[model samples]
Target: MLQQNLYNWRLVILATAFSGASALIYELITSRILLLFFGSALTSLTIVLIIFLGGLSLGAALMTIFKKRISSTGLVFSILQLTIAFYGILILSQFINLPKLFDALAKLISSPLLLQFTGGAIFILIPTVLLGAIFPLAIAMIIDGPNDQISSRIGWLYTLDVLGSVTGAALAGFFIMPNYGHTATIVLAGSLNILAALIVFPAGKKLRLAWLIFILLFTIVAGLAIRNQKMYVIPKNLATIKDPYRQSKNIDIIGQKDILWEKASPWGVITVTEEETELGLDKILNIDNWGQCSVLSHQSESLIADGALGGKPEADVLNIGLGCGFTLASVLNNNPHQVTVAEINPVIYEAAQFFKEYTNNAIDDPKVNIIIKDGAEFLRTSQEKYDVIVIDIEHPMIAHSSPLYTIEYFRYAKEHLKTDGRVALWGYMSSDPRYLKSLVNTFKAVFDNVVFAEFEEPNYVYLFLASDGELDVKTIDTKGNAEKLLESLASIEDVAPNTLDNQILQKYFK
Candidate 1:
């Protein structure tokens, strides 16, 4: 009997650790899913964290209130684990509808912050609450011994729980989500919860029968989720608060055939979709549902060729992003001595192969040297200076791209440039006046000379160029529109520049 009690105690400790790991894994994956529905803004992240922690607190309070009346904590803890597992699986199955739900909510709720908070609460509150109740119940289960040993037992349980949390975060971020994708990772987390429940089940004929039923139910539902896994592909619409889903032309299309290739990465979800346009086949690259570049889009080519070039014929160039490899191809066309491509997501480089015909297989070029690192990090660490540096990242409002638009980023770019070197950035459609003004001010604050040119062929996008020395405006202004564009930007005054400390750029996006 004593040996049996010792074995059960070990099992209870393991159960506590498993529960902690599963909870954290669920939280991280939940945050990633919310990032899809809510724009990847600071507000969206804060809303998720608040909802999770708040729900946990509420559940713990409720558990404490009811603890004295409960007779069988082992049974209660098992039920909580099973409940979390079942609910998590259901959410993973229904997560694809989040975009449509978000769109519906957008029509009713005018405030963006409130919408994010409400959506997060509605989606994740139950499981997080249930998760919160389990730890205290586990503590109650094992603290049935001497009063003196109870403290050490609680300390060990807490330590194991914390260690499990760290393990879960590391595995989810670095291994599971990246390799297995979101749906599979969530399923794995749910399965861990089920395992934890089994580990803590008290020995009895009736309880054993109940455990068998739970296993059967879990297997059936998990099998279904795995079978229909592809249905949970993240939506490509509603990239930001400024853009709505109904406004997209391809809103009518459904199913997963349109998604040519998709993968989840540490940075974000990298997706390649094919569109049968009137012109031809158009391949688009998207990061976290924000369209990065397209084969048919002239913006990437024009941004590099028209803006970044014209500095030196045999210039050594630095390209920040490799979307569709169009910008890299443009630089290569000019016969640069060497082109250093700094791309964060390696999956993006793989996706660019789909547009090899248009990109001239830029990723395979001998002159191109690929460095898979964050653009700003590369600039801060590298001693190599380039005659021209092009920033082809996504919009400044995006959480991942926000850092590259700050005053500090511009300074890094400046420090990595030669005396006469120039830097170019694609400011996609300066529709928001304050955003444009603040961005222009940020650029002007760092460089001696700043000039911008606007294009209207595919869509309205601005190519901004900055140099320490005088820029050849006559060469860049091929259509005689640079002067008017510069005048319009200069008219807006008293605008504060975006900096690392203030981060004013993300606000203009909202």
Candidate 2:
């Protein structure tokens, strides 16, 4: 009897470790899915973690209350594992409709935070709760051993569970999701849940052979069904969910559009979508559903190079955010002696080839050096100075992108600039004038001369030219946008600058 009990306890320990790994894997994968809807903001991650941990806490409380009712800890543990697998798969199958669901919820709830919380609960609450119950039950069963070294046993179990979680987070983020995609990663997690259940099934004569065989057959069929379901593709139109002004426009994003190219990466979901415009076919590059650049935006992007170079054709330039290679092409048009392009996402660099015509094949140019690193990080670490530094990144409201717009980032750019160097930043015109004014003030806080350029057609997009030296807007008017830029700089004052310590841009958007 002693030997059999020891064997069962060993299996329970193994099952506990597997359960820990599977739970973390589910959390990461679900958070990534939510990222496509909510964007790459910390808010998106916060909503997911809150929902997952909340459910786990509730599940643990329930398990403690009902411990006496469970006849066998091992049997109940096995059942919970199976339940999590089923629930996880069920949730994944429904992910394709998330955009429609989010839109409907947005109509009723104006708050993006509340909508994200509601969506996260819909997708992950059940599975996380089931995951939470497993740990407490494992402790109860392991403590049933001889009381002499019960503390040691519990410590070992806790250590294994934590190690398993670390492994799961590493694999899901760096290996599995990037290589096999989200569907396969979730399926793999579900398979581990099944293995955990099979391991802890009542051992020997207590094991029901019929039940074991039935579960094995059922899981195989269910796995196949999950594999065959349609994969979710985030619609191009749904990319504006984060912007309250855009979402208020009531853009219908119900149906799926044909995707030209798509890949899941550690950064986010990189998608290339083609749309027919009056001029021709325009391909758009989007990261995490936020449109980065399109062929049509090349004219606007050219202004970055125009303002930076200020007619110094041979000036060395640093261009950030590859985005369809439009700004790089514009930099090349200036005939810069050397151009270093810093782009955070490797996948975006790969997608640059799609816009070869519009970009003048900028990625393959002999004068260009492409470094796959964050623009802000590159500036801080590199000692190389440039005559012109162009910041062509995404909106400041994005959590990850917010860092690039802070006073600290401008200071770094200032450090790496030559005596007569100039910086050109692509600015987002927020619906709220306060945030827009804050951004301009932030740039002015770092440089002596700051010029603002607004486009005639796209009223929301603009450019900021900053330098310690005298920068004439007339000197860099390769395009006509800068013709009126000097007149607009007067109205921006009395606003606090957006800084790394206080994220004004992200808060305003939220």
Candidate 3:
């Protein structure tokens, strides 16, 4: 009897760990899934976290109220585990339909927040509630007597669960998601839950046939999950455009080239698409399905490089982002003495190979040095001072891009600039005016002399030049730049400068 009890305890512990690990894996995957549908806004992330934790709390409360009615705690625990595993696979099958559901909800509900909350409840909350009940149910099965010891036993089980969660988070982020991709990771996590259910199966001898049937069903489901795993991946956030599913049908008609390279990183979904332009086929780089930069427009690139380099010949230059190598190639046209490009995503650097025609092989140039690191981190650590520093990262509204627009990063750029050097900051002409005002105010706070220029050819682009020394606005005006664009910067009404503490661009723009 003692040996049986010991074996049961061991099984319970193992089951708890597996449950915890699987739950955390679900959380990580669910967070990414939510981001794909809702976007990478802070509010979206906060909503996901809140709904996840709230579901756990609700499950715990339900378990507490109905613990006595459970009849067989071990059987209940095993069933919950199997249910989670089944739902994990089920959710993957329905993954692609989320956008349609979101759109429907948006049409029905006037409040965006309410619509988001409803979506979260359906996608994230229900599954998390199942996950949250495992701990309480496992505890109920283990403790035979002595109500006073219940608290300590719960604490010990909680500790084990947390350890498992930590392991799951590390493995999912560092290995599973990065190496195996999202679908395979979801299968792996669901498999863990199935394994946990099997470990606890012996505790419910009265339901032996039921357990066997469950095992067989779960095995079949796992096989189906593996076979249909391609459908399990989180779809790219193509919200700015049409639905990704529908967009594929229009790709051929539009004559856009098939994706040259694509990678789903911890940062965001990175894709390279080729499109025929006036200057022949040009490659465009997109992060999270938002078109960031491309090598198609020589005019836009020239404007950015000219505004940044300030027509300095044979001067040292630093390009914060190396997207498609357009800005870098344009900077090279001026014959800069040396050029250093910092690109955070290594995938972007790899994708650049396909754009050799567009970039003129500038990445391979002897004078150009490329660093695969975050732009802000590089600026903070680098000791070299450059005559010109160009920050051509994506718009500030993006969660990852917001860090570069902070006042602290602006100061870091200033610290790395030569006494007479200029720092050119890129903004989108189509950006929210409030965000633009905040960005300009942030730059104005960092530098005494700031100039703004707008480029309307090919694409609408905005540029802000910041320097301690006087800027030749007359020269910029002579190049057909809009004077009103510069005047808008000075006429900003009431907005605070964006700082690291309060990233106004992300807060308000989103």
Top candidate on TM-score is 1
**Best lDDT among the predictions, by candidate number:** 1
- State the RMSD for candidate 3: 6.1
TM-score for predicted model 3 compared with the true structure: 0.86
> Model 2 over residues 85-159: C-alpha lDDT tens digits?
777665664576799888888899887778878877877888888888998888877776677667877888888
- Candidate models: Cα lDDT each: 0.77, 0.75, 0.74
C-alpha TM-scores of all predictions: 0.89, 0.86, 0.86
- Model 1, CA-based lDDT: 0.77
**Clash totals in order:** 0, 0, 0
Query: Residue 480 in model 3: shift from native, Å?
Result: 4.8
Q: Candidate 1 vs candidate 2: which has greater lDDT?
A: 1
RMSD of every candidate to native, in Å, equals 6.4, 7.0, 6.1
lDDT of 3 by residue, 76-146 (tens): 78788888888887785466578887888888888877888888778877778888788777876667557
Misplaced by over 4 Å in model 2 are 1-7, 203-256, 277-280, 456-459, 474-494
